[model samples]
Target: MHPSTLLQLALMGLFVASIPLTMVWLSADANKYRKLVWVMAFLTFDLIVFGGFTRLTDSGLGCPDWPGCYGAANPFIAHEQIAAAEALMPTGPVTKVKAWIEMIHRYLAMGIGVLIMALMFQSVRQWRKTHQQAFAPALPVALFLFVCVQGAFGAWTVTLKLQPVIVTIHLLLGMGLLAMLVWLGGREDYLLHPPAPSRDLAGLRALRTLALLAAIVVVLQIALGGWVSTNYATLACDEFPLCDGKFIPEMDFEHGFTLWRELGKTAAGHYLQFSALVAIHWVHRNFAMIVALVLGLAAWRAARQPALRKTAKLIAAVLLAQLFTGIATVFFDFPLAIAVLHNAGAALLVLLVTMLNYKVKHLLDVSQRTPANADLPANSYR
Candidate 1:
């Protein structure tokens, strides 16, 4: 990529990011910082969904280069190169349409980077002006670093030729970034309006544990799903209730779980077998049941608490939708829209769990601080 191309892409990101920044500045809200963080979180969610679209459409290698399309800022500027590639392999990955999709995804990612930078800047300014530690600058600084790392993985996704591990980590890092932003936003909301004391402090603590466990299970399930997607194994089995119409089918776990191999080959460099793909799909399919059960139990427990009922309902609904979409992907042969929604559903679950975790923590803190609870032993809440 040329210096000129880098500058142009940076300028484009700035232009795109400015739209939301302008809205934040123009709003009458007292806390522009909080509003900006929430907006970034929303946009990050959008980026995750669009990224799934890019992957599902096989646009990951549309440019065959990093940070630019064929060493140019946009697809139009690299039309000649793209056209040549497409001409060489008309049905391959380098079509003009894919170039556009790939570039647009990059542009959105860069815009998010710019917004996070703005957040860091504002945090520093707020701390300096108010001399208050409440406006901590550490998280914004951490976010800046995380996004840089995420950007590096994005580049590797293209340069490494869609290596399964790199692509899957890229997906996980994007979701992790969203989780951090939601946690930050929730913190801001809590500081603005602290929650009331809870009568059942022990229950709240248990709920927090459950929510965290659910989040872990969801992350694992997502990793399995990513492996399936990156390895192009969605249709390996082609049956839902049982793989290949049997309770157990021939599988190659050793080959399937080889982490450092290329996209569709085992560590020994042999072409990945159908049994390996079946193993990949089968594990993801079975894990979905575990995730559904754990998340459902958490939702049922959470719904009994008035403060958490609404978010609990949301959790339950998304879990059901995820189940439907996960099965639909198999039954419908992985339609683009439903497949993308499956990814989005995973993101939504991450957000909800993070939010629930934050809320429970907040309630626990309130319970600890109340005068009525002062007489109780520290472990009494447990």
Candidate 2:
């Protein structure tokens, strides 16, 4: 009966529908595996960025309720209640505009969930007929489960009142989902047939490890970055290479690392001190240097690979974009566009590294003996 409640149900309905709609679109080429994977990959990236937009804009709690705006289908229907909340606390996070942003983020997430499910289903169907062990649907199934868990984190992210640890974990999980999807998509693209061992599998192995480490560094940086954003600590250090005009500003590690507290609280229920905010920002900034060095090395190695040259160059370009965005956030006072893109760049880096890893290592141990995958198969129809 409440407007906010209605809003939640409507959004859930839209989320459910996006799955079937994506399936319908893919029906045109039920066999275009690589193309479908790329399409879904792009959509997942969009979801990540839009999600960043939702959080950075302080709309994560736009409705202050799960699934909708005061039980209504749209903000318009809940305008009276939202306006009342805003009037009570002007400049708070519960305005109608924010509620819409958060709800839209949810809708987009659900859509991506549907697309992955479809990819998994199709992989199963194709694998059955072709006996292609590569696209056997295991990873997709795993990702389907992972997305369910990610949804739970999304709920907790709000229901837990945006606890820093919970929010940071939620951001990591979302990026994790993106990495999984990108890996699957890349595997689907590369493993039409089992790949022959590279002339130097050892080099590939080293690169794989390097890529994984590169991704790990980026994720940690991203988590720190998320902490900074979620707790409104971006401006804790306004200068480029220093905080409060000093390289090592005063910092409170105890409060900053107090994992179980809400957005701006200490473990003992006290308001968070400014030093803690400085610590969060400082750690993230420092990690950026390490990430840059590792990514630079990984990109250089990838560039040397004949097949991976383009992807390697992409890695370099994205790093440049990411670096520019990060600095811009500080010098430019964290403009919404740059902040959102900075987050998006991290997601992109994750996707690229995951895809690169998959291409190099997703070899299937297939003895299927199918004429399709033989020495000179009838066609590369897979």
* Residue lDDT tens for model 1, 117-158: 999998999998996654789989999999999999999999
How many clashes in candidate 1?
A: 0
**C-alpha lDDT of residue 23 in model 2:** 67
In model 2, where do residues sit more than 4 Å from their true spots?
1-30, 125-130, 193-197, 363-382
Model 1's alpha-carbon lDDT is 0.91
For candidate 2, the lDDT comes to 0.79
* 1-382 per-residue lDDT for model 2 (tens digits): 5665655665575666566565657686654676666777777788888988988888888977665567666688789999999999889989878888987887777667766777789888978888786667788789889988998998888888777788888889988888877877676666554454334444566777888888889888898898998888999999989899999999998889777887788888889999999999999988899999999999998776666677899989999999899999999998999998899999989988887777656522221333334453221222
Q: Which candidate tops TM-score?
A: 1
For model 1, the stretches where C-alpha displacement exceeds 4 angstroms are 374-382
lDDT of 1 at 280: 93
Q: How many residue pairs collide in each prediction?
A: 0, 16
